[model samples]
Target: MESIFHEKQEGSLCAQHCLNNLLQGEYFTPVDLSSIAHQLDEEERMRMAEGGMGSEEYRTFLQVISNALSVWGLELILFNSREYQSLMINPINEKAFICNYKEHWFTIRKLGQQWFNLNSLLTGPELISDTYLALFLAQLQQEGYSIFVIRGNLPECDAEQILGIMKVQQQQRPKLIGEDEAQSSGQGSVLEAGPGVVEGVVDEDEEELRKALALSRQGMEVEDEEADLRRAIQLSMQGKALLGKQP
Candidate 1:
């Protein structure tokens, strides 16, 4: 319920600050900025030094945090825009969000029925309306911006139970197909045409943009997969360290 801010360490430590806030006073041990920063790969470290994180770097950072939290019986579920909207509609307990608005990241936590935006740059938590959230999301969708939802603090369970739960969730959720894939499969368009266009009309230029964006997103996903591999190695090293073995 408490918020964490970067204070003087704005750009580089936003994700770490957010994680620290989420885990502090909880059953799990809180992680510091230095510990989080230490896990970054060489490229990410360079990105941090220059200020701000790109999409892939941010995804990598989340994976690192997820791996760390898993060691302590917590879950971190990353959701796309559609999944995020579904989550908002059917709110879950003990979950938090790391939202990207125009490439700037911030946190949103749900306490009871109210959603609070715990932006580090802000002095205090700001109340967020469901309508506002929906509209904001719609805008992001229109702009083709990436949205990520991170749900944490799930009930501690064994790997099998976790996998089963995830499988069931995936089956129940709607499949979000990429624009390029949808187009290639003759699905027409991804986003609904704007006011000027006819209800079902798809613009040629818009379609091309969507295709380009989809390709770009695909490239980022590859980078994210590599990041996952790196984080897995990092987590393995951390585990060995805890066991008093050389990593």
Candidate 2:
């Protein structure tokens, strides 16, 4: 697992990190996912409009990741889907898994004969033994993660090739980057998914959406500051602000 590809936690782009890690490269970016999600959103919006209805869900999340990944001939099957469950009692013939809990996304992929947890939350990839794999998947299920089994050929990598040639022994297991601090603070750490504060995309609609979010946040901050100042002036006029005695 020494050559394991991992992307550390960066902003709320875990979905981006997860997909890229699963593919073992920088195959995706936040803008890339956003454009795909926006396309999906547009399709859903049009579909709803055809029925004289409006959309509810944002739908600018992993649904876009799934769509984008499909270009490489990768198929993601829900672990809880009846189709997969009926076919196998445990995960078999799987290359990788995309796990989501809350809005955070991560990957677990089998490189060569061993599986590795390529979670961005973790400092690095954690080695997973074959015997412990089933238990780990069950634990994730119990912890409310939606697991998607990835099927189809994955891009070849140094780790996969090196491991395929000869397996490496793990001397230590990797831990979440902020495991101790999060536990002490009584917080559950998560890197949110979806279109976020990211760079512009080539897609016109996607760029427009990202610009809207940025402008809206900026406008809100300006308005909030103006409102606060107005309130302060009003309070001084009413003799409520006696500290500076400017009134």
Candidate 3:
């Protein structure tokens, strides 16, 4: 994974610069901060210039980038601070990451098992140890600072296979139902459902299966929305030259 540092730009465009570096490659084109800024409403752009982007604006920007990248079969996943463990454990090949530290944003890239910090505000890329990164995340959590993990170029996997893996993992762990749901199901004392059979087992199994199906349908709906957004962006880019030459 090649680490692309952010380019120096005016105003509070750190997030934009970090995203541009993250998406620069064959599968995804580099993002232009100026073009994005121009597209924003006057008030939103002014907010960015005055005090940096808020959470909602940053999320919308990420969605735009994600929509563009989806054309080439790439996906971006944003994990909140609560999901730091999942972000650290998952290894997506040749991906870029943007993380927040001390209210400032920075970029990071992973090559094999090693991580490199490519903070444009700094002098150069610095090799970061996994242990150190974990400790830093813990400290951030303790201080109640907002931390985010933006991962690009997720690996493609078969939907069925992914679901199978999820099912297996869920089965291995104990399931916690809400107090009301448990009472209604007449399984109030049950902390977890064992592999063995129990009373009203068929009904319980049917309910769980229905919930899984609903979740699967929701996932398909999201995929459809992403595909539609990708097509719209592709059409918009057709024959419309980008401002300035490609970086």
Candidate 2 or 3, higher TM-score?
A: 2
Question: Would you list the rank order by lDDT, best first?
Answer: 2, 1, 3
The TM-score leader among the candidates is 2
The segments of candidate 1 whose C-alpha lies over 4 angstroms from its true place after superposition are: 1-11, 24-33, 36-59, 81-94, 101-104, 140-145, 152-247
Candidate 2 vs 3: which has more lDDT: 2
Residues 1-247 of candidate 3 have per-residue lDDT tens digits of 1233334322355555555445433232233444543466546633433343355655555555555545546565544434555546643433556554322444565533555555444333445455445444444434333444544344332322333343211112111212234335553332333231223444544444323222222222345445334322221221021101111
The alpha-carbon deviation from the true structure for residue 84 of candidate 1, after best TM-score superposition, in angstroms, is 7.4
Candidate 2 lDDT over 207-240, as tens digits, reads 3333333322232234544533432222112111
In candidate 2, stretches whose alpha carbon ends up further than 4 angstroms from where it belongs are: 39-60, 179-247
TM-scores for all predictions: 0.42, 0.64, 0.42
Better of 1 and 3 by TM-score: 1
Candidate 1 per-residue C-alpha lDDT over 1-247 given as tens digits, one digit per residue, 9 for 90 to 100:
1222222114444445455444432332224434644645546644432343355555565566566556656665444545544766543343566554222345565444444555443434445444445444444434433444554453332322333333211112111123334345444544332221212345654444343333322322345445334322322222222111110
C-alpha displacement of 187 in model 2, angstroms?
Answer: 17
Instruction: Report, for every candidate in turn, its global Cα lDDT versus the true structure.
Output: 0.41, 0.61, 0.40
Cα displacement (angstroms), candidate 1, residue 245, comes to 40
